[model samples]
Structure formats: C-alpha cells, structure tokens
Target: MERTTDPVDETPLTAEEYEAVHAAVAAAAGSRSRSLNSLFADWKDVVEDVEEGYSLCAPEFDDDLACRDALGRAWPLLPPRVRAIRRPELDELDGRFRAATVPWPGRPEEPHQWWRYRIPLVVEAEAGLPRPGGWPLGWEVLPFPKPAGVRVVEWGRP
Candidate 1:
C-alpha cells in the first residue's frame, strides 16, 4: 500500500532485518496495548488521502471514517519515540495549516474541530514536502521501534 515518488536511497533490508523490525514494532505496539497490524492498516487509507491530495475529511462519519477514527484512536498507542519525533513539528504546522486552509479551516470555538488538521505527516506531505522522499524526508520512519538499523518503516513501499 506504500507508494513513493522515488525509490529508497539505502540498500534494501534482508529477511532477517525485516523480522527484526516487525518484532520491534510489535513489541512497541504491545507495550501500548495496540496491534502492529491494525495501526498500519489504518494508515493505509490515510496514505491514500495524502497521495490523492484529499484532506478535507469531515468530522462526521463516512467511508473515510474508519481510517480517520483508527488514526485518531491509534495516536496515543503509537510508540512514544514515534510521537515525540513527529509531534512538535506537526503541532506547529497544524497551527499554520488551520489558519491558512481554504474553506476547510476548522472552527476554533468547537474544540474538536480545532484539531482537524493535526494529522502528522499527512499535513506536511500536502504542504509540499517535495514529492520525492518528502514523505520520509518529512523524516517519517513511522511505527518503527528504536532508531536502530531495524525500523518498521514503509514496508508496503516497494
């Protein structure tokens, strides 16, 4: 399900590396009572949204709601390392994004709407992280474990 404008720059991971990453990510997910498979699965559609340049998700329910809900629900469950890496930048960008967005600018009065643009990499990607490795050049090696050689990165990317 992963798609990128360019191929990964580094040498590809071997099967052992792949298992290690999966185990690490799974461990991290288990620590937080989440499922490794489920979180990335949620991201599947969110990534589609980024690729399609469609970010005007409604607060109400729809076909998109499942992925949206999953992402939101999975936020706290994400590894602390992952959140720490993405949060600060996403917070700042979200502020600017909420202000500059066209009609989709969410209402500040409604607290829930205020957070509509807080999606981490997706916001930055739409804001033009360039199109190459910008997805990760946003330096986003998501849902990964420690910054070891093994990272539960975009396994879906081929």
Candidate 2:
C-alpha cells in the first residue's frame, strides 16, 4: 500500500462521535499507559523503529513471527506525524511482499496466501489502530501440508 501524505484519517467525526470518543479517552486511566510502559519494553519507543519494522515486514512474512508480531503491536501506538513523513518512503521501496500459493490441478482447497497466520493482534481493533486490510483474517490457522517424502515426526520417535 502506498503511504499517504497523512496517516491519520482526516475525516471529521460527528459531534456525538467526538463527544463519546473524548469521554471514553478521558476516563481511561493513565495507569494503563504506565503499565504498558513498564511491561511492554519491546513496544517501539522511537518512531524510526516502527517505520523500520514496517518496511522490513512489508516484503513478506519473515522466516519467523517476530517481525510480524512486533509490527502488529507497535503500529497502533505510532504517532500520525511520523507516519505522514515516513510512510511515503515505501512508494520508493518495494511494495509490501505477499507470499502466496496457487491451487493444484486436483487439490480441493483454494489458493492460499499463508500470511500472518499465527500472529497475535495483541492490540484489538477497539484501540483505533489501523490494521492491514490484506491480512489473512477469518481462518485462525491453516492446515499445513507435509512435504513430499518428509514423514511427520512423532514425539519421542528417533
């Protein structure tokens, strides 16, 4: 996705929506932010880190989950000003990478983009974070196929 000039949604909120959101935010205790600071040390403290991680993971799901999970958690916390400036850099860079597979001639299953399969959405949508629209959403987990000639390794078997 090409980064826009402004990352935050600029559409104005209705008066009722604005009041309700303001009240909810105002009531939220500072304790929650403090606790996140104390416990979530890996939460990106610098905007540069979030931008860097976003660029890295955009290419494809990394060999492991660390980059994906990190992005999922830190993305919501990023400030709009930073995203406005840094997100555009992506247009110059490669488009977000997608790892996809095609259906076989006889395989009943449809083509699958086995991306973001196990990553956690630690920050839920209510937090107002902008999640990637293309994430593999509905299926919680995909059934992995055994490779040709590679038998399933059972626990405790040599």
lDDT of each: 0.40, 0.30
For candidate 1, which ten residues in a row score worst on lDDT? 144-153
lDDT of 1 at 51: 41
- Candidate 1: tens digits of C-alpha lDDT, residues 1-158: 12223334133455664454445554544443444445555445444554434344223213443443444554555545444443554465345534433222232344444434333323322332343322334334322222332122232223
TM-score on alpha carbons, each prediction: 0.28, 0.26
**TM-score between model 2 and native:** 0.26
What lDDT tens digits, residue by residue, belong to model 2 across residues 1-158? Answer: 12344635454445664444333323332222322222223322222232332222322323333433433343335444433443444222212222112222234642232233322211012222233332222211224432232112112223
Show where candidate 1 strays beyond 4 Å: 1-44, 50-61, 85-106, 109-158
